[model samples]
Target: MQRIIVIAASAGSLDPLKQIVSALPVPCSASVFIVLHVGPNQAVLPALLGVLTDLAVVHAEDDTPIEQGHVYVAPPGWHMRLETGRIRLDQGPKVNHVRPAADPLFISAAETYRERVVGIVLSGYGDDGTDGLLAIHESGGLALVQDLDEAKVPGMPYAALYGDHPDAFLTAEKIGERVAALCG
Candidate 1:
């Protein structure tokens, strides 16, 4: 089955995000999605992240068909969700006071892909991604968190660890390696 990876990050996440994306092999078989809390008008992230990875990286757009080897970054001000084989963007009420909060993306991926989903929570403030990671876990999807020691900001990872242990707690690089292995 084709795998789907949904990642969430906030403060101090750029480096890890870069590492994770850079680690994926060229022509990866899984579709990747990301949500990073930033200003509504902030739109340069996709290009920044695209520089380090061979995968096609683009700002997610509504109705874009899901494609393997592509990295879809949630555009600022819109919540990105996976629906069947396409992308869905919405301006729905923000969760955790963030438009592109990780919770909605993770939950949506979990609901849509079930065991085929992998939810990853990286360095970030607040507990925005915890419940969604739990949803992924409960849905038989893999849930991973950056190790507290390695996380630049521990709130998000800590919440996932304390609320319900994820499948793995790893460094950002290791997380990327594991994701690649899973999709391999």
Candidate 2:
């Protein structure tokens, strides 16, 4: 099965993302892509996520082939896209007030993978992932939003749920379980 999972988060996300990634099943067979808001000059995110998860994590490279068992991170200041089973990096203008916006990645994945895609909108400020998650849902992909009660910053997920009801509204632990189920 071809699987593409996108994880979106923003403020107060590091710890929650770490927990969710760490709890994910080992030797995952899905191509996991992460879009996290970060300062342009911040340290590498893939390295940080790698230390927290057992999965092989690396920053996405333009034209790099997508492979299972690897976790790819959108490099700071760039939007990550999926095209013909490979990664495409874009230094385009910011969308939703974020450079490495979640919408672009989710939209790109929906276009490329359709029903094979799974979009997760986690804790965050603003509404970066709201439109993207809707796009995913419209494209026949599975959409998940973090439960507001469990979110550190509930704006993103709340916006997503209100904008379009996701297929799953889950807590962090349940989200991990659902992701692992998707990989399975």
Clashing pairs in 2: none
Write the residue-wise lDDT of candidate 2 on 52-136 in tens digits.
7778999888999999988888989999989968999999999998889999999999988999999999999999988888889
Leading candidate by lDDT: 1
**Cα lDDT, all candidates:** 0.91, 0.87
Local accuracy of candidate 1 as per-residue lDDT tens digits, 62-142: 998999999999999999988899999999999988999889889889999999999999999999899899999999999
Candidate 2 Cα lDDT to native: 0.87
Per-residue lDDT for 3 in model 2? Answer: 86
